[model samples]
Target: EAGVAQSPRYKIIEKRQSVAFWCNPISGHATLYWYQQILGQGPKLLIQFQNNGVVDDSQLPKDRFSAERLKGVDSTLKIQPAKLEDSAVYLCASSTRQTEQYFGPGTRLTVT
Candidate 1:
């Protein structure tokens, strides 16, 4: 009966520094997603996972970003050598088959 959980609700880092965000999806949910939202823009799906396998990652910046779902339960997203453009809110969402998604409180990253 719990929603997704994300760590370090806010982060501040210098450009080029690395950062990682964690997410724990709701129980019994089979789909998990990671999204990025910049100011004034809607959230963009970065990666999606069905269980522990990747379903889509076309929008993910592979050169600087990576994500993984562990044992079909939890996930982590990492951005290495972060850019100023990477400053945004990272959102985690999960859903069961044929159902609406539940979102986390998100991690807000500030690149200075």
Candidate 2:
């Protein structure tokens, strides 16, 4: 099966600027999750979607971030007015309620 896909691998942005990331989950998977992983820590769930419908988004910082999964296959995460503390790895994972989740290489964000 094809693995998850993410873009840019790395990103550098000034504080208070804007940036975005993209993701494509595995085929036949219905559950997709986005996670933010800071240095020296575990990945934190940012948002979750099941077939175009959000199942969880409580941890996402809506004040400066937004996300969408229109077709339920691909998704995008955006940050406007980026903060210095917003620098982290944005990871996308997918599962079919069975085995371990497969994660992408991730987009490493650096805020200057």
Candidate 3:
């Protein structure tokens, strides 16, 4: 099977600017996730979707970040007025129930 696909492998932006990252998961995967990994920490789950419906978003920074899965196939993560603290690698992953997640290459965001 083909792996997950993400666009713009790298991004650099000024603080308070806006950015968006796109992802296309493996065909037929029912669960999609977005995660953020800072320099020294593990990837933290930012949001999760089960077939176009959000399952968890408590960890997401609602004030500035948002995400959605469309038709349960493609997903996008967006940050508006991004902060310096938001500089991180944004990863997209997908899986079936109770299965291992396949991650994309990730979009590396740098907020100056």
The local lDDT score (0 to 100) that residue 93 gets in candidate 3 is 94
Which digits, one per residue and each the tens of the lDDT, describe model 2 over residues 14-44? 9989999999999988888999999999999
The C-alpha RMSD in Å for every predicted model, in order, reads 0.9, 1.1, 0.7
Q: Please, what is the TM-score per model?
A: 0.97, 0.95, 0.97
Preferred candidate (lDDT higher): 1 or 2: 1
lDDT of 2 at 62: 93
**lDDT at residue 90 of model 1 (Cα atoms):** 99
Model 3 C-alpha lDDT per residue in residues 22-65, reported as the tens digit of each score:
99999999999999999999999999999999999999999999
Model 2 ranges off by over 4 Å: none
TM match of model 3 to true structure? 0.97
Per-residue lDDT value at 82 in model 2:
98
Among the numbered candidates, top lDDT falls to: 1
